[model samples]
Target: MILGCGLQRAKKRVEVSRTMGSNTGDQFANLGRALSTTASVLFSAQPMEETILSYSSPYKKLLHETITNTGGGSSLVKMHRDLNLSKGKNKGFQDIYANSKEFFKNSYSDSKTTFKVLSYLSDDLLEDVPRDTIPKDKNLITESGEKRARKSKKQDSTLFQGFEASLPVINETIEIQQKVTMNSDMKPITDSESSVSNIEEEQRQEFSLPNHLKAEKLNNSYSSTYLKEAAKSITDNLDLLEIQKNLAASEIRELDIKLEKLKLMRELVFKRVAKIEQHELFLEKHLNNVKDRVDMIIEYNMDKEISSSDDELLSRVSESSPRTGETNEDYETAATTPLELKDDDASPLLSKSIYQQLQAHERKADAPETKKAGSSKKLKDAGMPNRHRHRKTYPTLQQFYETGSKIASFPKAHEEEVICLDFDMPFGTMCSAGSLDHLVRVWDLSKKKQIAAMSGHLASISCMQMDQYSTLVTGGRDAVLKLWDIDKAISEDNGDHSEDTDACVYTFDSHVDEITAVSFDGDNLVSGSQDRTVRQWDLNKGKCTQTIDISFATGPMRSQRNAPLHNSVLLTKEPPAIGALQCFDAALATGTKDGVVRLWDLRSGKVVRVLEGHTDAITSLQFDSINLVTGSMDRSIRIWDLRTGTLSDVFAYEKPITSLHFDLDKIVISNNEPTIKIYDRENGNHWFCGEENSELGDVEFVRYKHGYLVEGRSTGDINTWAI
Candidate 1:
């Protein structure tokens, strides 16, 4: 038995020693595991820290050798746990190590829990870790960190230095920009403001007036100069206007004066015209009265001649009455009772007596023996009255011989002076006076009585001519020519005329001036006028045939002034100024105021001859069968032989010879002398004279038979004388 107990004790001692050593090793492992796991948890939770600590571990050689042989940190942690638990747990001493098992379980649980809490603390602490606290494993981190630190320091330095350095530059640049902008903006504004101020100044200057206009305006504005200047201008204008008005008024006044003068002159002229007209009327009335008396004398003379012839016829019939009737008284009365007077009023006894005388005169004449006897018997037996026989006889002037030496004379026929005279053939005459009163007298030459008075010519009877074709043509200064029919005038007094009888057959209004004379040639009439023209008219046609222009040759005479003899002789030589014209067939003879007489051939329209020698105008011309007798103011009568165109004879008188007449054997001359003179043409001697009781302005003489004279005087007196 003693040998078994000693071996058991020794085995127990050996097992206790082994368990202590294992417990010590297990505690160490648990402590290290706890530390490792805590560190791992811290590192894993902070990966940047873990990564940094991996290289910067305090046990870097051992941890590197340990992790290098193992898989990594996780594998190391797992292996360490396993080795600690396995080695720390004892199965053969189960009853002796049961308390250690609980200890181990609790430690393991706490460590794992501590590891988890540390892991969470590490995660929380990572956001707060500074970059400088992060450990670097290589120089890369250290160099990078150093570089970054240097760069950051440089950036900070650059930022702080740049701010400090750029402040003045930026401020200076902005100030320069602001100054440039301010200068640029202010330059234009300054220029514009200056321009505006200059413009306002210029406008203000322009509004001020010039010196002249200013002075003028001021003068008219406030002082007495204003009123003075205004008054001066107004006065000048008013003076000019007044001058023009006065000129117009002067013109009007002149017109009024001229009008008044013209009106007064017109009135004076009209009054003179009226007085002239009244004077002419008086003259015309006297002329007409003389013409009527002349006509009455002619009728009375004719009646007296008829009565004397009848008295002779009745005396023969009474002597033939039977004494102591041889047969019965009734038978004797029947046989001689005016021869049983024929029913025809014609007187057979007178016809038989004239026929017997003519036959006796023929028988007394010798005849040719060869004349047929039957012709001689027929000439003897043929019986006709001598009523158709014409006697070429004229009246003689017994007083003309006594007054032959006198050129002019005046006789007392009437108390008034005789201005004109005309003869009414067969015992009638007319006369006019120079009185302004309108009167003319007609006288009967046979009875020596005034017959009637007639009037009406607006002017003096300047010239007169008798047409002798039962009409008288007269002209006057009234510029009119009137024709009077003498036959009709006498017929009206006889109470045997028609109411339509034309007393005045025609009138002419041709002369623009005074009619100086009128004359007729056959049926043609000629008029002379102061218009210096002689107009030839066909009185029947009542139209002008020719206008003879004598004005050109007679212009000097028209301008002549009637003056005293010595003064008038100093005037220019006057041409033949026509005063009267006479037509002898187709030839015209003009008596001119200039004493020269002109003869014109009507067909050739030229002057044939100018008869000179008279010292004054030819007052009258008488044409005869062989001679032209002219009476002139030269107090001489001249006879022209027409065939030879020569002055045949000249007779001198004491007065102007106003008229001349020619008969077959005698020449009669009338002057202003109150007598008519008869001259024997063959002897050129005064033969007979007929005296008148008035100035014989005109005269006509008719010779009836031997020594019988009939003379007409200006006093409308006709004297019959037996010489």
Candidate 2:
């Protein structure tokens, strides 16, 4: 409508000019053309503004198609018309005639033409013009005598004044936007810079800059709005950058902590290395000292042998050299008789203790009263069994595990399965053999012969313990306890089995059931039996001095079934079965067929604590210190810390364990599979294997003579192996 009015005014001007003259009409024509061009440029800018404002601009596809398919002459106007075409259903927007992806490409030339057209017209209208085109203008300026910067009142709708006033502002704003678009200093959106669209909604409100833009800025230059938006984008990007920086700092702190830990570990490693080095040096010195001692001993022994041989030959020659007062017959008798060595002539090779004892023995032979000192305290002390077990250099646990080997074997040592065995290494002699055969067989290890078999038990011997002077006390299934004089049995050849009660030196038939185990603790004999009782025997009186009922304390073993029971199973009532038993200092730990291990306090005759976990009857038990290992019919061996009455470790097997034993760092277990398994105690790894324990044997450790494992099989095989 504005352009039409401009054209009409231009026509009117022509009429007025023609009335004046032909030269005046051409000036009117120039004025009319300028007005018309400015109006055309303003109208054309509407779609271009829309294009720049929206990413989904109508210009893009058409412009793109035009540039790519220029050979097809696809123009901007043609593309716009096709986009407006309607198709099927509502016959709407999807219908297009001259356009598709194939025809669309960017038309940069068309965009440039539009910008150039606006600039050309704006420059012309505001720039060089003929001086003859204008008269001394009437009211062309505001009442202040300068053109009005803003309208004072509403302009006449019919006049072109408002339209002319809006034109220059539009032109300058577009020019500025174009400059910003082409500027190198105005940063382009970068991939690293967070988009204005992606900033959190809450954050956008929080970091929002004040909206200071007036309506004039929106319609005209829009400089303030652009600047405000630019500021907000910068702030959002700064916040994102700050967040990333904080995350990086946290990671650095974690890395620093890890670095400190590494340094501490390095320090520990250094300390350990220093200790190891010191140990190495000490070991080297020790080795050198030991080498010197061994060499000296070897040299002394060699020299002693040579001197002794020479001395014997010289002594014989001297005996034959008769003195003037001595008869030849007397000299001959002295030389022919054994050369008895006096104290001064004793061999240096003999140990002091052995030599002293030999001298005493000779004196005792001469004076018979010395043999009566058996009851003397000093003599008892002197006769205490040698507890010093001769051992080789103790090997490390790892060395034992990797290189374990059997050292000895004694096959068929008993007629039945040897339930238990004990060693009797008396100070003056060795008679170390006892089995479940109801007889104590004494083996002379020096002579390698079985000399005496002390027999007394009427039933299978269940348990036995060796006392001082080759004395052995045994408990049996017949519920009888018998103490044997091992030396007397060997020297006197006493009848094996004696039924006369008065003839038996020490025999107690106090137990009501089979005696399962026995332990010699100091002066007392602690015995466990199937009668659910542990009796401390008084050897002097030949009777049970104290009895702790293990079956059901304070209750009868068999009662009327309907009677309400006052207590659970205790020491008085017989237990299911006393399968295994062991005695410590003041307590007895007993394993039963009911799968419970009870620890009884000997003084109070009461159960101290009961440990339970096995699902099947316990078969074997071995303990060191307060720690115990029990094997059960459940095919598992569980270790317990008896001090705490808590289970500590478990080892599972395919077969029920029949017997088990352990030392400081090794565990040896025999199962129904007839095989024995040895494990490293700390690691629980299977360390070695042995087949000697096959056939359900009783295994015993011979720690004195040699570190040998002895197993007595049910199949009448006894094998001792080096460990």
Candidate 1, superposed: residue stretches over 4 Å from native: 1-416, 428-444, 450-454, 493-502, 552-579, 687-723
| Per-residue lDDT over 1-723 for candidate 1, one digit per residue giving the tens place of the 0 to 100 score | 343453455345445445665543444333343345445554465665444444454444444343323221233344334434655463322332344334324322345543342233212123333333443432222311232221223111122233433454466557555655656576786765665555556645764222224546655587687657666555544544455555567789999999999989977876666455445544554544444444334422332544777889978866996665433221111011132233332565443222233344356568543323332232222211111122222223222233333312234443433334444332233333221312333444434555444344565555566531334667665567765554445445333222322344555768755566567765567888766778887554455677887765455434323433232211221222455567866788877777777788876767898788778877677665677777787888888887888998887877776555466767666665656667786766785464454544445323222333444454533444433
lDDT over C-alpha atoms for residue 669 of model 2: 72
Q: Which candidate gets the maximum lDDT versus the true structure? A: 2
Q: What alpha-carbon RMSD in Å does predicted model 2 have with respect to the real structure?
A: 28.8
Query: How many residue pairs clash (N, CA or C atoms closer than 3 angstroms) in each of the candidate models, in the order given?
Result: 38, 34
Which one is best on TM-score? Answer: 2
Stretches of candidate 2 exceeding 4 Å from the true structure? 1-404, 425-436, 444-448, 467-469, 490-505, 553-576, 692-706
